[model samples]
Target: MFKRIITLVILVPVAIVLILLSVANRQTVTLAFNPFEPSDPVLSQSAPLFVFLFAALMLGMIIGSLATWFNQGKHRSRARNKAQEAVKWHSEADRQKAKATELARSSTLPPPAESAPRG
Candidate 1:
């Protein structure tokens, strides 16, 4: 939820800016060149205004996602490693506890030589 809000907060203004810029410059822009066509079209007319704005928005989203992933990559791996280590340590401790219980049960009787001599 927070992430979504943050994304919207940052992207909305950028999208608005791009849209406004496109709208303002629409008149000055011309259709894009087309080699297939006998005559190249004006650049602005070539692509719809919405298409340009959508492309820019998508580009921004991709950059934002990549940046986020890159930034979190190390921390994610580190957390995973820590969890694995914790599991390993717990299992080792369990094994040690089992060994201790077994030792206790098996050592109830003393060695014959260590037993008190008969009166």
Candidate 2:
């Protein structure tokens, strides 16, 4: 229930802003790919202003994500090392537990006599 509320709270505002951006930037704009040929463009295409805006937004997000990931390389490395160490410790513990069980079974013990019911 709390998750749903949080999702709605964040989603509603973002959806409204994106819708407004798309509506406001609906004008058609031409993009020229051929920078050398300024007078006679060999490659050019017209797109909606919203397309450019969305493209820029997507590009910025991708760059930011990559930069963040790259910057946290040390943290990732540390996490991996810690996980490996945990696995090693767990295996050692399991081996010790098995050895203990084996030693307990190896010990000579007399069987218990049957007890009569008191009831």
Q: List the residue pairs that clash in candidate 2.
A: none
Worst 10 residues of 1 by lDDT: 38-47
In candidate 2, how many Å is residue 96 off?
Answer: 1.0
Tell me each candidate's TM-score.
0.52, 0.73
**Taking the tens digit of each residue's C-alpha lDDT, what string does model 1 give over 13-57?**
988887787777554333455656635544225456556666777
Could you tell me the lDDT of residue 75 within candidate 1? 99
The stretch of ten residues in a row with the least summed lDDT in candidate 2 is 37-46
Which tens-of-lDDT digit does each residue in 41-117 have in candidate 2? Answer: 45876889889888989999999999999999999999999999999999999999999999999995979888998
Most TM-score-accurate candidate: 2
